[model samples]
Target: MIEILSPSEITRARATGALVGRILQTMRERTQVGTNLLEIDEWTKDMILEAGAKSCYVDYAPSFGDGPFGHWICTSVNDAVLHGMPRDQVLADGDLLTLDLAVILDGIASDAAISFVVGQERDPEDTALIETTRRALAAGIEAAGPDARLGDVSHAIGQVLSVAGYPINMDFGGHGIGTTMHQDPHVANDGRPGRGLRLRPGMLLALEPWIMVDTDELVTDPEDGWTLRSVTGARTAHIEHTIAITADGAEIMTLAPGASS
Candidate 1:
């Protein structure tokens, strides 16, 4: 569904977005070599419940994934990209980890993701992948504004990732997010400008740009029936943020309170 949030709803959305941002930030700060993915999930669950908010993912039963995600967040490792279910695995040095989160606070939902290296071992390729996704996400946000076509945002993201020599995957991309997570106005990572849905005030969008180092193909891991891995086993990175269109332009709601954009 395409939802144009009311003023009050938008206010609530900001709260939810802040919570999501803080949780992700906390997770990033606490994560290090030897940290377990399941531990991160547990921490996420505790934080959401403590804040009196609901997890958009726990009971999520989308067709693309197995019924009922039953997890608090997505933990994509080096080769994994999307829908990465938290497991018993422990993070190691040089591991590229992506944490994707969405939560509902006061009936409004906000979503965001961040990719970073696990420990002190920073591989140049891994750093580049994460930086590329971050740059692409910035480009997408820059292209978003009232009356701007969704394609423009997608094109901007594609231009950044493509120029960085990464392959884009169209199957899973950004989308409209509001009262519930994953709404309409599907925003692909790459598309032609001047096409697709037009932006409007009060519209919330999750603009994510993710890419594989070598190929666009993905393989679903049967172990959890949720994790999406690169076909060539290449490393991947994803960056996302929930944005709200306003009279002036787009405001990044998922940025942590007091954090610079």
Candidate 2:
């Protein structure tokens, strides 16, 4: 189902967005070589409860997943790209990490994600992957606004990733988000512009651009049945933000306090 939030609902969504952003930022700051993925989940749980917000992942049973995501945040490390269930693995230096989060506050929900390297080690390939997703996300946001075609956002995002030499993965992409973490009007990473659903004011969308280094195919972890990894074992990155379409343009509601999107 597609949802267009009311003015007051959008106001509440901003608070939810801020909370999601702050959690991701906090996790990034606290993470290091020795940090465990499960620890990140714990930190997220604490913050969500403190804010009186509900986590969109925990107890989330979806067909694509094993059922009951059972975690506060998604920890996609290295080749793992999406739906990564937190576990006991300790991160190493140069590990590419992606943290995806969604939360509901004041009956409104927003979602966002960030990808970064662990410790002091940095790989040029990893940096490019991370930056490309960020750029793609920005392109998606720029293409969204009142009366804009939904495919325009998809096309813009696709152009960036495609030019960067990364194959687009169609299994999962951005989607409409409001009271729930995931909604209809599925936004593909690549599509033709001037097509698909026409965007409207008050629409909320979580635009996430993710890619694998060498392949577009994804393989689920056998043990956990959740973490989605690259078929070729290549590194991956994902960047996301919750945006609200307005009269003028898109407002990035999930940006951290005093932070730029």
Most lDDT-accurate candidate: 1
lDDT of each: 0.94, 0.93
TM-score to native of every candidate shown? 0.98, 0.99
lDDT of 1 by residue, 130-236 (tens): 89899999999999999999999999999999999998889889999998898999999999999989999999999989999999999999999899999999999
Clashing pairs in 1: none
- Where does model 1 exceed 4 Å of error? none
Report the number of backbone clashes for model 2. 0
- Model 1 gets an lDDT of 0.94
